[model samples]
Target: MRILYGVQATGNGHITRARVLLPALRAAGVEVDMLFSGRQPDRLFNMEPFGDYRTCRGFTFVTDAGRVRRLGTLKQSRPLQFFRDYRCLDLNGYDLVLSDFEPVTAWAARRQQVPSLGIAHQYAFYHRIPGTGSAPLLKWSLQLFAPVDEAVGVHWHHFNAPVLPPLVAPSPYPLTEEEGKILIYLPFESMDEIRYLLRAFPEYRFRIYCNIPAPETQGHLEFEPFSREGFQQDLCSCAGVIANAGFGLCSEAIQAGKKLLVKPLQSQIEQRSNAVVLEQMGLGRVMPSLETEAVEDWLALGSGTPSPWPDVATALATWISTGRQVPIQVLTRELWRAESGNMLSLC
Candidate 1:
């Protein structure tokens, strides 16, 4: 089947998930074309995985100092161009369209009267789950931005729902001895602030990854350019992770059994809700801001037991290739087993 896959480029998490799913789809003998939206065309990195994907001026949020800037986001959005691009897309030859919460391709598929499937964490909001930041505008944006026929949501826990486990990169690095170091990836925050926050913890070594450049070294802090290889290497050696309460990193950290300290982005409902759930599940600790006390407290705690990460990419690919006609409960069970790491009969 010929498929059109749309991925949101706002944050690296969406791209990271797509990286895992794309290869699985190809291995299943599906012809796929990709479209990427949100963020400028020039800002993209690690382009090797996504082969010649289309680009558009799709929706994205604006953030300042670790907070989602609502007014800034509105001022920056280009609605006219967004509409024009949506109306102009041609979905004539494709058998199916898949979206990772990308707006342009979803709207185009809707306009063309084509069946579309939404594969994203955002879709989980439709179900009964823990949530925060419940303004009418945010709700409207999520629903209208990426509408789809079938929604397949991913989460860290099942919550007695049909959500699947997070799609992590195939484990490239083996688990290593704890080196008393911490990996920090808070892309939404300013580098200066991050540096200041870590300076207080002189005993712990911090390897920070950021988009902006940094000086050679501070007393106990080392700044590095963002590279998948470098990040993974640092992560393997680190005892824990200090990052925003974003789903992708948190899920991966849990699978690795690393201790976690997350700071949910301000005014971001999804992130705030994720933090709440993470606390409830005993998966990690959440902080309202990048406070030193919280980081120190998290560092003092022991790591949780590793949760097994099943081959979710393979399972989902198999289901899609078979035409996705299975009952929701059956699919949910299969996915839950993969997430839960328990071998029990699905009655």
Candidate 2:
């Protein structure tokens, strides 16, 4: 089947999901044409996986110093262009549009009455999961951002819902505990603030990945430009992770058995909810801001236990390739059952 996959490129997490699933889809003999939005084409890197992909000026949230700037976000949105792009998009040949919280293709698929499937952590909010408070705007955005015929939510826990486990590819590197080393990825926050936060822990070494012109070192802190290979290597070898509560990075940290200290992006419901669930699951610790006291306490914690998530990309790829004949609940049950089995084996 020919599928037009739409990815939200505002953050690396959504793209990360596509990176995992696209390969599985190809292996399953499904043809995929990708469209990415919410970020400029020039900003994207390490995109060897999705060849000759398309980009659009889709919706995106603006942030300033780890807080969502509502006014800034509204000012940047081009509703006219958005409508034009979706209306102009030709979805005739594609059998399905798989959206990862990408609005352009989702709206196009809906307008054309084509089948669309939403697969992302945000879709997990459709169910009665944790950390969903009385936030009307959040609710509206979640529903209106990317509506689909079928929603497949992914999360760290199922929460007694039909949600699939996090869509993380297994790490290629062997897990190693390099003590006193922590990998920091807080793309939404300022580098100056992060530097200040790290100043207290003089003994510990920090490898921060961000949008820098080049690699630089200052005492125990090392700042490097975003590189997939370098980041993965550091992640696998590091003792822990200090990052914003982005689903993709946190899920990867959990899989790598790295202890997590997350600072949720202020005003973001999803990040706050993720932090709450992580605390509830005892998988990680949370700090509302970059506080040295919290970091000191978190640094004293022990190593994390990795979650036994199944190969969800392969499973979803197979399901899509075979025409999605199986019920979602059945797929959910099987994946969770497989996870349980893995947990038992580990025990």
Tens-digit lDDT track of model 2 for 55-124: 9999999999999999999999999999999999999999999999999999999999999999998999
The count of residue-pair clashes in candidate 1 stands at 0
Give me the candidate number with maximum lDDT: 2
lDDT score, candidate 2, position 283: 82
Which portions of model 1 miss their true places by more than 4 Å? 133-140, 213-215, 340-347
TM-score of each: 0.94, 0.97
Model 1 whole-model lDDT (C-alpha atoms): 0.83
Q: What TM-score would candidate 2 get against the native?
A: 0.97
| Alpha-carbon local distance difference test for all models | 0.83, 0.91
